[model samples]
Target: MQSVDVAYAEEWKMDHGIMVPLHFLTPRYDMDIIPVNINCQGPPLTPLNRVWEFGKALRRACDSVPEKIAVIGTGGISHWPATPNSVKIVEEWDRDYLDKWLANDKEALLAYTDEDTLKDAGQGGFEIRTLTAISGLCEGKKGDLWFYEPIPIFSVGCTVGVMEV
Candidate 1:
């Protein structure tokens, strides 16, 4: 709820900030949404800058939390969004991510670099970074894809998947 003098984005997102809010907005909460950040009473924590570090941290999260919390990973399979030219789909990178994710191959899945992700998927592929973070949160869980669609008009690949606790 950080804001300035005037109004601000009701939902300002960075990294994976939107996930917690989105999780509550779903029907599981009986349509009630809580837009607040929970403080764990520790030093200000920043998400790991690199994927490898992020991968290692998930195990700690799984061990620490004593309750069941569902995590949804939303993003894309592969696409170059906002391109005026023809669409480019990086099926290879997308499939690799999916495979590693399904197999719970933390090391391989977290080793992805921005360069590789963008080059193969495009700038819009940046959204997948959120999915990676979500993946870390879902280590021991299984995921089910709700939907995946490639929009040629928007040059975007949109997908939504859920991992349960």
Candidate 2:
């Protein structure tokens, strides 16, 4: 095992066109917890500027690749009501969140953060970051959310979206 600093440094070099370390937890490694600029806390973490940079990178990468890209977004449609009325509860707030997401509004992107909301929404909630990543590539385009399914047995929310350029 390597220290976090050593591992992180190796990972940092990958951003500058170097071969990523074998153990780095990137998409290639079947891990998806990517570090956002906000979490970097470094000199390069200017919010809007960084977002633009990410947008450019995503666009370039997607254009460079010839494979069809599937943009999936997960989470939401959860309400922790004090009284359990029924097994299924519809959440208008969550629908509004999805609306803003499909609209590709960056401001709306940053507002949907609550650990409780994520937990209550379940596994698919982890997919929100996927939406955020796709948003960078689809900044000014119209997106369609084609699927929204809640699996109460697993306490998970799943959604699939497509971005039109």
Candidate 3:
């Protein structure tokens, strides 16, 4: 595994990436959250392979603990955010990616290069690191897509899924 810094912040200012899901999933804000933010927003981004290893490590860590854990990966699929092409939904690309994700196809998921993601799925596609990580966490487990829709007003191919751990 690659060496990376893992720190705990006592005080964290929630961003939309963290807040939106919390708002809907834990609306009461009653559960504890250990937020893990991947560097999917900028360059020198975490490589897809490294992200997969990290996800595996995360699974090991979670398994070592007795507490019940819920891993939620939230991100856009194929919408260009903050760009002129914003609201454009590449349904085909999103669906293809989802297919690989649901199958937990490590080769196909990690095969995506940043340049390819940017060109084919747009910048927001980089957010797929989260999904890829989930694939790693579940490894051999297959996932089910409970919901998926391209909501232009929301500027994302909104998706919800669960891995069979």
* Per-prediction TM-score to the true structure, in the order listed: 0.57, 0.49, 0.94
Per-residue lDDT of candidate 2, residues 61-124 (tens digit): 5577787643332223453322253244344545665787788887777555545444554323
lDDT values, one for every candidate: 0.52, 0.48, 0.90
lDDT string for model 3 (1-165, tens) is: 334445577887878888999999899999998899888889989998888888888888899899999988878889799898898999999999999999999999999999999999899999999999999999999999999999998888899999999
Prediction RMSDs, each to the true structure: 8.4, 10.3, 1.7
**RMSD of model 2 against the true structure:** 10.3
Q: What C-alpha root-mean-square deviation, in Å, does candidate 1 show against the real structure?
A: 8.4
Q: By the lDDT metric, which is better: model 2 or model 3?
A: 3
Candidate 1 residue lDDT tens string, 15-79: 33455445646636564332323211122322223332443354455467786544434455566
Backbone clash pairs for candidate 1 read none
Candidate 2 residue runs with Cα over 4 Å from true position: 1-56, 65-90, 113-127
Taking all chains together, the TM-score of candidate 2 against the true structure is 0.49
Residue runs of model 3 more than 4 Å from their true location after superposition: 1-11
Better of 2 and 3 by TM-score: 3
* lDDT measured at residue 13 in model 3 versus the true structure, 0 to 100: 87
